[model samples]
Target: MTKVLPSLLASDFTRLGHDIEKMEAAGADIFHLDIMDGQFVPNISYGMPVVEAISRTASIPLDVHLMTLDPEQFIDALAALGIDMVSFHIEATNHPHRLMQRIQQSGMKAGIALNPHTPVAHIQHLLAEIDFILIMTVNPGFGGQKFIDTCVDKVRTLDALRAEKGYGYEIEVDGGINQETAEICREAGADLFVSGSHLFKSEDWQEAVREMKQ
Candidate 1:
C-alpha cells in the first residue's frame, strides 16, 4: 500500500494542533516536517521549537526533512526531540555515511534527499546504509511549486536500482505531489508520497488523503 505523508508546511499554523488531529484521523501515515535554514535553501522554515510542539500533538511518526547547510549540526537535537526519521540533502554533506550512522545510532531512520538535477548514481554506494531516499520533484526551498515532469524518470531509475541491488530503502517523493502525480510516482515504484498544498487546501482532507493513497 502507498503511504501518504502530508507535509505540515502547507497546514494552517494558527490551528496546527487541530490540523494534525484531523490529518491523523484521516489516516495520514507520517507527518512530514520541512526544516529550512536561510543559507541552504534560500528560505527559513520552522525550527526545533515548532517541531517540538508538533511532536507533542502528532500521533504519527515525524518525517523531518532538514534543508540546511550542515544537517549534522541538528542530528543530536532532532534525535533528542524524538524524530522518527531525518532526511538531509546529499549535496550538503561530505560524509553522508557517517551521518547515516549517527542518525541510526540516535534511533532514527536516516534518509538522503536528491535535488531534481541530481543523479541516482551519486548515492549508489550509500543505498544500503540509509532507510529512504527523498526525490525532490521541485526545488526544495518553498511549497506550491509546480512538479518537474522529468523527476518521474528519476523515480523509475531509483526503483530499478533498488530492484537490481536488492535494497530495502523506501522511495519517497516530495513537491507538487497531488492525486495525479502520486499515481504517476506509484506506477514508477514510489511508495511514499509527501503532499502539501493539495492536501491542506482541500475542504475534505480525509477524501483528499484517501484519493492520494489510491
Candidate 2:
C-alpha cells in the first residue's frame, strides 16, 4: 500500500495544532513540510521556526522539503530538529552527493526532489546515495495547481531505474496530488505521496487521504 503524507502547507496555520491533530487522528503516516525560499523557487515560505512549531504538535514523522538555494548552509539547523526526513532539490545543491551523505550523517533520512521538467535520469548516479526521491507533479512555490500529466511517465521511469539498479529509495510524489492522480502515481511505483490543498481544502481530509491511497 502507498503511504499518505499530508502536506502541512495546506493545513490551517491559524489553528495549526488542531489541524495537525485532526490529520493524525485520520491516519496520516507523515507530515510533509514545504520550506521555500524566494531565490530557488518563486515563493518564500516558513523556515525552521514554523517547522519547530508543527514539530511540537505532530505525532507522525515530518518530511521537510527544502526548496531553496544553498541548502547545505541550512542542513545543520534543520537537523537540530527531530524531523525524520529532509529532502533538498537536486538542482538547488552544488554537491548533491555530499549533501545526501551529510543528511545521513546527521541522522535524518536523506531525499532528493526533482522538478517537473527534470528527468529521472538526473539522479541515476546518486540513486545509491539517498534514501528517497520526491517527484514534483506541479511547479513548486505555490499550491492549488493542477497535476502535470507528464509526471506519471516520470514516476514510471524512476521506478524502472530503481528496479534496474535494485535501489531501496522510496519514490515520493508531491504537488497536485489528489484522489484520482494518486492512483496513477502509485501504479507508476510511487510509494509515498504528498497532498496539500487536496486534503485541507476538501470537505473531508480523512476520506481524501484514504481515497488517495487506493
Candidate 3:
C-alpha cells in the first residue's frame, strides 16, 4: 500500500493543529514538513517554532525535507524537534555522506532528495548508506506546481535499483500528488506520496486523504 503523507506546507496555518488532527484521523502515515530557506529555494517557509508546534500536535512521524543550502545547519535542531526522518536536497550540500552521518548520529533517519532535473544515478553509490530518498515530482520551494510527468521515471529507476541492489531505502515523492498521480507513482514503485495543495484545498480533507490512500 502507498503511504499518504499530508504536507503541512499547504495546511491551514490558522488552524494547523486542527488540520493535523484531522489528518491523523484520516489515516495519514506520516506528516511531511517542507523546510525551505530563501537561498536554496525561492521562498521561505516557517522555521523551528512552527515545527515545534507541529511536533507537539501530531502523534505520527514527521518527515522533514530541507530545501536549503546549509541543510546540515538544521540537522541537530530538527532532530531535537523529534522529527522521525530528515531528507536534505542532494544539490544543497558539498558532503551528503557526512551530513547523512550527522543526521543519523543525531538520532533521525537520514534521506536524500533529488530535484526534478537530477537523476537517480546521481546518488547511486550512496543509496545503501541512507534510510530513504525523496524524489521531487515538481520543482521544489513552491506548492501547487504541475507534476513533472518525466520525474515519475526517476521513481521507477530508483525502485529497480533498490530491488537489484537489495537496498532498504523508502522512496518518497513530493509535489503535485493527488489521487490520480498517487496511483501513477505507486505503479512506478513509490512507497510514500506527499500531498500539499491538492489535499489541503479539498472540501473534505478526510475524504481526500482516504482516496489518496486507496
Candidate 4:
C-alpha cells in the first residue's frame, strides 16, 4: 500500500502530542517535519527545541525536510534527536552529494527535494545515491497552498527512471496532498504522500487520514 506521511506543521501545536498519538493509531507511516528558515523560505518554523519535543513523543519515524539554507549545520543535531530521514532541497545546496553522504553518515536516510519548476532530469545523476526524492507539488514555504498539477508528470518521469535504472529511492510527494491529489500522484508511482492542511485541518481527522492512506 502507498504510505501516508502526515505533515505536523499544520497540526494544533497546543495538543500536538495528542494529535501525533492519534495519527499513529490512524495508521500514519511517518511524521514529516518541514524545517524552514526565514532565509531559505519566507517562513521560519520551530527549531530544534520543538523538534526535540516532538521526537520525544512521536513513536513513528520523523522525516525532516530542510527548507533552510546551509542545511549541513543541522545534520548532527537532527541525528542527535534520532531523525529517521532528512531531505534537503536541491535549490538550497551547492553540494548535495556531500550533504547526502553526511546525512547518511549521521545515521539518517538522505533525500533530495525538488521544487515545482525543477525537472526530474535535474537529479538524474544523484538518483542512485539518494534514499528518497521529495517532489514539491507546491512552492515550498508555508502550508495549504494549491497543488501544482504540472508536477505530476515529473513524478511519472522519476518513477520511470527508477524502474529503468533499478534504483531503490522512494518518491515522496509533498504540498497540497489530499485524497484526490494523493491518488493522482500515487497513479504516477509516488511512494510517500505528505498531507498537511487536508489532514490536520479536517473536521474528521481519522476519516481524512483513512482517505489519504487508501
Best by TM-score: 1
Assess candidate 4 and give its lDDT.
0.93
Position 87, candidate 3: lDDT = 95
What TM-score does prediction 3 earn? 0.97
Candidate 1 C-alpha RMSD relative to the actual structure: 0.7
Candidate 2: Cα lDDT at 98: 93
lDDT of 3: 0.91
TM-scores for candidates 1 onward, in order? 0.98, 0.97, 0.97, 0.97
RMSD of each: 0.7, 1.0, 0.9, 0.9
Name every residue pair that clashes in candidate 1. Answer: none
Pull out the clashing pairs in model 3: none
**Weakest 10 consecutive residues, lDDT, candidate 3?**
117-126
Off by over 4 Å in 3: none
Checking candidate 2 for backbone clashes, the offending pairs are: none
- Residue-level lDDT tens digits of model 4 in 1-214: 6888999999899999999998898788999999999999999989999999999999999999999999999999999999999999887889989999999998999999999988877788899989999999999999999999999999999899889989999999999999899999999999899999898878887788788877
Off by over 4 Å in 2: none
